[model samples]
Target: MRKWFGQSLRLGLAPDGLALVRTSIWPHERARLLAQARFKENNVEAALREAERMLADHEREGWALRVVLSDELVRLWQVAPPPGAARMADLEAACALRYRALFGASPAGWQVRADWSATRPFLASAVPQALLAQLQQAAAGSGFRLVEVAPQFVAALNQHRSMRRPGAWFGVVHGGVLSVAAFDGALLAAVRTAPIPEGADRDWLEGHVAREALRVGLGRPERLQVCGPAPKAWASSAGRLKFACTLFEDELDPLWPDSARLAMTGRAP
Candidate 1:
């Protein structure tokens, strides 16, 4: 089980769109879609309009909102544990500093969110504060309170809680980017996101996977669970490395919204 972040409703923000869903934890209840809309990436006006439209369609008063942002807008990193940090603020500062050093960019207007539950605690995301503020304002105006903002990859992983196997690798290929996450039992071992080169072939995909696994010190995974569109020859290629590949056909759909809903309810998709 995961710690409660306090929200039963979710709004998924993608580089190209947005989606909203309400979830129920009751045995006999089911999750429902409230509203969804698409917009061009980096178009602030279009995003705002879609957000307004989604909020206007639902009676969201008193409903908690969890926003899962696209990986394109957030950066995830795995860093060493902070030394002698005694408070959350101190830890956050250290994380920010590390992020700045890694990316060579100012963290002044970036919101850092970390997860300290693993043996090698990591920063889950660093998102632009301005973007977050816009989302918050939109939710507030809609009579809903924004409770949490998370990365899309993290949300997608949360949806596979039941399928998580120790010493396994999981990948999601979406929006021309591939996100690979390694897990050992309930602890996240390593995570990486890389862009897929245009017209990449099966060999290139296999090589990329091998390199990522090496970077994470996993050597090779016995199993690789994958979602989203992938080359048809990927399974056979991975089999050469002794990895039993499993693809979740259902997860191949637009994932942002489904991941958001799963993140809120901790339910398998």
Candidate 2:
């Protein structure tokens, strides 16, 4: 059996601390939540000290700690590592500290927009692509499916479009997050996902969307739409990205279950 735990943080280069949202996944009722929580509760300093202890006692329990860091942490990760030596496990541990400090939990899977500065490295690295492919495989192997990478803003736009509301304009949804901004033909108060995948950056997309949001006079977006996998992680993005509405987990999951199902039957969530 496979066990998963995840958390997200909305961090930045600026003085303002990063924002975060986090959660863990288990075999529904199979795994012991308390055990998972105990393992996750370890701090970097504490984690290092308890490493052997954890490995000896809980390693066999089955658990994976996944974290979604904001842009700031990504920067730290690059320069934070000591020049001499750093283990992969150490890097992951530091990442855990950064993520935990911001969001108070660890994120298993993450979805970030194209604009965030932190996302740049991830986009360039093999990690995200691997994660994407791995996610597909995991879903297939586990019989789960991953849905569209639609943002909350796009969900609102779709909803608005269906209602036949006026003042509707162009919309884009990436990674289950939303960015709905009213286009007044003069300015756009657009909002988008911020707590993107660590190292994943939307170089050109960030400026492009923000400018468009301003140009269109993006006003307060309607409702926050929740659809597809990692909806909770999407919610964590909202705290930092500042979306107009929030999506309900139950609603989104039923409507758009994990797309991994396409690869495997009866294995989707």
| Best model number under TM-score | 1
Badly placed stretches (over 4 Å) of model 1 are: 1-8, 26-34, 82-90, 117-121, 183-189, 197-204, 215-218, 228-241, 249-269
lDDT, candidate 1, residue 94? 68
Clashes of 2: 53
Tens-place lDDT digits, model 1, residues 1-269: 13322336777777566667776556455556767766544665576578767876774576777787777778887665666767766666667677888799867788876675323566467788888888888888878888888777776666775776666688877667778886655456678788988888656766786788778776667677876665555665523655666665652234444334333432344
**TM-score for predicted model 1 compared with the true structure:** 0.74
Report residue 150 deviation for candidate 1 (angstroms).
1.5
Candidate 2 — which residues are off by over 4 angstroms?
1-28, 34-43, 48-52, 61-219, 225-244, 250-268
Q: Per-residue CA lDDT of candidate 2, range 197-250, in tens?
A: 443333333444455556645543333333323334333343444333233333
What is the lDDT for 176 in model 1? 73
Candidate 1 clashing pairs?
Answer: none
Task: Give Cα distance to truth, residue 214, candidate 1, Å.
Answer: 4.0
